[model samples]
Target: MKRVIRILISYALALVLVIVSMNCSFVNIKADEQVYLSVSKSNSWESEGKYYAQFNLTITNNSSKNLQDWTINISKSGGEISQSWCCFVSDLGNSYELKPESYNKEIKAGENISNVGLIMSFPAETSNINASISPVFETEVKESPNIKEEDSNKEETKSQESVEVTEEINAGDEVETEEIDENLANAALVASRCFLSYADAPVIAIRACYDYMIVLNTEPKEEQETIAEAAVTAAQTASEFATDGDVESINTANNANDDNNAYEVSKDNEPVIEDSNPEAVEDNEPVTSVAGNKNIPTGRLRVSGTKLVDASGNVVQLRGVSSHGLSWFPEYVNESAMASLKADFGINVFRIAMYPREYAGYLTGGDKETLKAKIDEGVRAAANQGLYVIIDWHVLNYNPNEIKDEAISFFNEMSMKYAGYDNVIYEICNEPVGADWASQIKPYAESVIATIRANDPNALVIVGTNTWSQDVDAVVGNEIDDANVCYSLHFYAATHKDNIQNKLRYAINNGVPVFVSECSICDASGNGGIDYASANSWLELLNSLDVSYIAWSLCNKAETSALINSSCSKTSGWSEEDYSDAGKWFMQAIKNQ
Candidate 1:
């Protein structure tokens, strides 16, 4: 076994050297030869006189013991990084120091870590890259103690059985891991990391990998996961956890490979009652609020031939602010804040952004009840203030289809809870990144829509488009065949100029119902300098088309897109001085409407 291990290590080293020599990249291992860092150009392209490339780095733990607290250094010559994932990089003038995130800080013996890389651009003439691992400790390789052949065979048999158990789990078969060796935990962690390399793989495989990482507590650097047994347990049960749903229709939609029609809803399944309090309002009766004024009038809203219309058939253009992630800013989700926005800011819509994968997100270990309570409070507050509320399933780092079952369960419950409320609009997906409209996203949306329609048949539904909801034109001809559905179009005035505006125009011109669910006057990152000129242009276009629009956020965080000044701690009843620059501008825009 030791001889085989040495041979494999030698082969890996030779392969790294070949890649280095061919690509002009570099590799450096610790002096003790326990760890190795190899850098190679995984991809490259040329645009005009500039060269663009992605460098993939692999770290191998060659020692017979676990390696930790290490760093990789890269001496980059004449290239500017455009994007990077899986490692925290520090700029060191001509070089960069990369440190592993918490979940990947330790690599077990003979394990290698991949999916740590970056993309950069440089002048066509310069493309040199040098990489080396730091603090090379000198340690001699130790031989394993010999064991009797009889005992060795028994241990090997146990290890092989454990391996078979994990395979069974991956195949969606339930199995017992009581006799599994604990050491397999580390192997699972390494396995999850390798899974990241399959970017174009099937959604189930990626989701299972994601759940595996989460279960192992090995959130990669990109999002950040942890635990070997828990990781194994996650491996054993992640698919089951992902596919948890009560209704057969939901289970069908959750199955990515199921040929069942995406638009089918099981009417036989009763609406899930989220709350059963004796004092709770009757399920069939709509909650009516007498909180209507000229500035903030509300009623059932419907999509009518490229326009959002009120019950009276008059074209209605909604204008308002969206909350930052509810988990992050629960303090702002109060009735007083809703009243303030309605009375002072002249806004009629409030979007509650519930992230599904961010810190304390709904699907990622967030206190589900707590987040749901906040959503409930926001919905009721908006209704009581005569404001239409958008329940946004904010998907920043994940695709909508990756967690379709969870989404189905959530929207099912929410739609049921707010079934009778006319002011509540279900924004099924806030922003879907790297999702196809015709294939992945459309089907996911149809399934979710079918679920929503089960309870609230006529409630307005907003669906996100591809590429962070900016590709609204993609839905021009391939729109969802459901009534009262609008495609989301998000923008930041500083980043999305006429190109995005043209896309919106194209969608609208092609008779696609469009809703600007989230937007800001700053850059797309929700930061950077405010571009009021571009914001005004956007408002002008939206107003002319009578398109409803909502600002990116209403939080007081010290950022470009925050509506309130960071210094103001007060959650409601803000004076003119309490508004951020973007906030003040948005306030005036709502008043103008």
Candidate 2:
């Protein structure tokens, strides 16, 4: 009788605690009130008696709870939408309802989702097209006596089970660490939420958690790896979700998070110009050493009607690889390595990437003279190997105009230094993120081009487009006046799909000179799995169009984008086995071309 009374008392207490927990869960009922929505419209383009307008929608969640499966009501005065991204639209009589796609369905608390836009086509006669957006928050249900008895019973059982598990864990019963540490699988997701919540969360913090997840993935025990794989997938998905299509944030996070620290420096295979005969490479030769040799190729490169042409108006496609930053990978620029590539692969061009914003970069406390010397060496090496070289001003973190004066000074000096060399090309900007084509990038490019033209008038100059050089279509009608300039288009095959390919096609068809300044077989983050199919398709398109393309990059860093294997530290003369997976694919692609 005493045992039964005690059991009943315990059951009563558990039921009371369960009721309290259920009541607490209702705190999120007013979450919809904390969310805000705004819409802005811009005229994207005018074509064929139709005006295309983009309605960019932004949703900001201020609540502590995440918002998912959300709906927004958009009322438009005129025009019909041709296409939309990041959301699905449904017509409901006079208005439209928008729902997020599965990938971006959840908007974490305190985070805002931008770049959710739709293009609407309006007849040229229609001058005023307007749209308004409002979130369709879930209806609030009041607490009533008519509650479902079964639901209450289920909640009670769940709460009771949770309590039992906690008690068991506290009692020190043998429990699988995986079961107890299930939250580890969700660490990335939680961290992503936290990142969205805090305005000052360091990027390295997120990278540390992601790196730990990678370590979990490589665990020797299968049981331990189950959660690790989940964490990795969650990290990738969370990374995608957190950025909400912002290219700058994605690139910054990616650049900071790549597995660069995992690289091994091989003492035996140091980056040196080794040769059977030491006299093959002469020291400190200028570009004029082979200036008059017709066999080594002569004449300045010019842009002629969507094609890079020689002085004789013959179309030429420059296929080559770009170095990883010169400050970090200077040893890869030796003459023997370039000569070996020219002999084996028939590569015609080489790009020297000089980062200006990263650690040890030119603009950030690095030895400017030392970097300039490295660039000079690389240019000389490429010129000696009968290869055209590109001096890349790799701008990533800031808009081109943000550092316009510095760019002008840098380009002025470089162009004057290599003015007489036909083999030297200038990439004014590597990847201009978060800059407008008509205002920011174009103006800055014009300034730099003007400076370069003062010295090398006919030199082939490449300019980056908006959205980290992925939005080539943005440069179609609003092109720079200089005929020698080519707009840059960069892509990572695994992340970019037909939409990006369509941008390239549109740019080419519209006579916007397109040059793929940087591309790879991995994701945009530069450290994910390879997409051979997409890469092959992209190469086929480039080949058909005779568009110049460059692979990124030349280094032994343990990332998917690195052309060389991390284990093999040789800077040049890479055999089949010395290539990473993406490296091998890129090498074969270049060879096939």
Candidate 3:
């Protein structure tokens, strides 16, 4: 019985030892399998421009014991993990897996296990990276292997070298840095210089280039301050070569950062200089006592170096053409065609009709592109001909206030472009009538005239009286305050509104410059007019009064007093041969005066 008891005890002891050893083996086991993992990246990166950054990770294991069911985790401070892999282990465990966050490999004692790969993206903007790796083992028992000190040291050195290279690249110290490219830098410099030269203002040029460089460098905070400072210095240097009215130079100089303190120096000295010149202040005095009437056009109309005089002085015949609807008919005013006709005819001025339908297209929810093209083509053609082109804001049925804003924009663009050119004038509103005259037309006309004069002080502006330009009494009553202003009135014998001679007398007597921008022997319905017979009579009266007259139509048609028939053909009414009849008589009248 004693012998049997002893044997049972020994068996029990053996079982306990086996269980304890199994648990101890797993705790002491070190992965013996050799594993290798690496990462790679691409050269191109962002949409705005190109960039390059890649994170590479390599993992290797060398041990005698099998590594089964282990976990490995990797963490990087400034990179995005794009891909990962897992490994499987079998033996001494039912089923185990290794994940990227916890990368684990399973292999036999002498075999090697490695992750497929891991890809990470590091942006160029990132400056640092802190990596952490952890490995958990769950396999057979084995002693931990001693890694070579030299090999560990080599890995640390390589990592430090990689960090240094990344730093250099971020700092733009790399040979491939775009900002530092000699060709690119030179191009930028040349462009900036050209801009400064043209602006004639060093401050403006400097400011523009500074902005450009900021864009070129993508406005990085680190580069902004440095580039801005450099731009200021460059602009100041350029300003030394610019003249007083050299806007480009002034702009460039003003834009320079270094000159910011000196930007308003000239302005500050203006008061002192102005005080010294007493006559200057008097000359600059406002033209009208009305608070906002300072911008009115006030200049004497001169012809042949002599100021135009009325019956009180020498006779001055103004031979003008009523260029009806010329802007609406840009095709007629061709440079090669109309220019020659105008010069040959001795036509000094032309009337422009503003059609509401054409202008409303842009102002009232219509196609802007089409309207702009039409306007640009018409204005440029007339200007190129060197003929005094009138910008007629025609409102046949007045709604002046309704179209005021659009009208102002149109006039401003016109005046600004033609400000210094002597061959342009403005006609505020055409043919306003009835109650619309006082309530809408007058106010609207006043606004437009003010806008144009603000941009072009010397522009000759024509204002029409109410009642379709037939109310001479209303015109003389309202009376424009501007000296350079003139009144426009239309006459058609068929209407019998007033005698042409009587109207002329009233205008001359009142000392108001009268311009017959539109008139026709043929009635509004386009009938009745014995060709030159009636037209010649009207022309005689106009010539006598020295009033400028533009014929009703340059091209003959059913709706007009056709000066030239369709196809530019001389019809029975007025042939091309006869086209010169009215023009010749008008020229003779002017020469006689």
Best by TM-score: 1
Top-lDDT structure, candidate number: 1
What's the TM-score of each model vs. the native? Answer: 0.59, 0.55, 0.42
Sorted on TM-score, highest at the top, how do the candidates line up? 1, 2, 3
How do the residues 56-123 of candidate 2 rate in per-residue lDDT, one tens digit apiece?
A: 56666676655533666555545666656556678877756676643344566687666466667667
Q: How many residue pairs clash in each candidate?
A: 8, 0, 36
**Deviation from native of the Cα of residue 189 in model 1, angstroms:** 32
- Candidate 1 total steric clashes: 8
| Local distance difference test values of all predictions, in order | 0.64, 0.62, 0.42
User: What RMSD, rounded to one decimal, does every model reach?
Assistant: 14.9, 14.6, 33.5
Cα lDDT tens digits, model 1, 124-238, are 7454466666522212212112212232223221112211111112233243342122222323323322321212122333333433343223223322322322333433433
Model 2 global lDDT (CA atoms, 0 to 1)? 0.62
Once model 1 is optimally superposed onto the true structure by TM-score, how far is the C-alpha of residue 513 displaced, in angstroms?
Answer: 1.0
Pitting candidate 2 against candidate 3, the one with the higher lDDT is 2
Residue 140 in candidate 1 has what lDDT?
A: 21
